[model samples]
Target: MSDEKVKIDVPEVPSVLPPAEQKKWVETYKAAFEEAQNDDPGDVVKQRQSALREANRLLRVEKITSADQAKALPKWKLVQCEEKDGVLKVVTIDGKKYSFGVGRGAKQQAPAGQGGGQNGAGQQGGGASTPPPAA
Candidate 1:
């Protein structure tokens, strides 16, 4: 395999959140989402939407440029990934949406020293790699 390092263009993550407010955002989002899920008011959709909006407002997504960046984002804050026009859009708790095109000529290269080689077999006098019986 070619020993070329694949250049994966990751999304640009903005330092929007302050260190002090990290916990606050996490707690607020969890509480609001949980409330909407458990309370089950008549207008469940509306309630959930409102909660999502608040969470989104607090999330303050600044710049999401690519799918790799979107994937790199913390899973806790992500709601889902939507596809549109051959692009993958990342939706973060009803916040600003960002998308990236797939198969944009991204190269696939293996690391320099980690070639696909056979793993050590029967190192412990066994045909397959297995653990000793429980004692």
Candidate 2:
């Protein structure tokens, strides 16, 4: 087999600003570089190394190994949770509703009719169920 290495080309990120804004960016870079050079070399190197290490640590991918750990993750406030027709309906404080199917052989309980099909905003189920107010 040939030992030639495959080359991959990466496209440059496109800038949204016009050419005039690009010139202003160069000025900003020069000012920042000058300010950085004014700092002590040893201190600057230490700070840069620390920042890079922290950034790499943060960027590293993490896996959730357990259901308990996954449940402990930060999430939106649950406004309401109820079981309806073998489906678990969860509504969050932001008015988003999610439905999860109940597993086979699991206990199925009928949800109380109170607050059924209504969101935390007191509005009926989303999408065409309620008419828009008159303009």
Candidate 3:
């Protein structure tokens, strides 16, 4: 129990991106901001409308062809796979809890609570015998 003060040294965290790349990115953002500020309001509105239409079109056309495609797609994590339904669902990791189905190929899978051994042996009434005597 002393009144002495201790100073702990903490190292600075290294940047994920190289300094040159970080500077380039900052400049790019700044230039984009300035350009947006100087652009005509009508032009901005038209650009936004075109972007919205393109996004809607892509969403309407998007489909998952395979499990690998679904896993490679951004912003979603596969939570469960059900072969009987020919559908697999994924939830978005970005706090949205958004779920979407991906088509699965025809494959037989064990039915729920049947033979998967998910339930304990005790619950299934499989007899558990006590060990005779310690050696």
lDDT of each: 0.49, 0.40, 0.35
Worst 10 residues of 1 by lDDT: 108-117
lDDT for each residue of candidate 1 in 1-135, tens digit (9 for 90 to 100): 333332222222224555555656556656665566555545546555655555557665546656677778766557666554455656675355444555643221111111222221112343433465699
lDDT of 3 at 68: 51
Q: Which candidate is the best by lDDT?
A: 1
Q: Which candidate do you rate higher for lDDT, 2 or 3?
A: 2
Residue 109, candidate 2: C-alpha displacement in angstroms? 18
Clashes of each: 1, 0, 0
Per-residue error for 28 in candidate 3, Å, reads 6.5
Stretches > 4 Å off in candidate 3:
1-31, 41-65, 74-87, 93-135
RMSD of each: 21.2, 19.4, 19.9
lDDT (10s digit) by residue, model 3, range 15-126: 4334654455444444443344344333544434343333233222134444455457543133343322443443322221222233442331111233334331122334
Reference-based TM-score, model 2? 0.24
- Candidate 2 colliding pairs, count: 0
lDDT of model number 3? 0.35
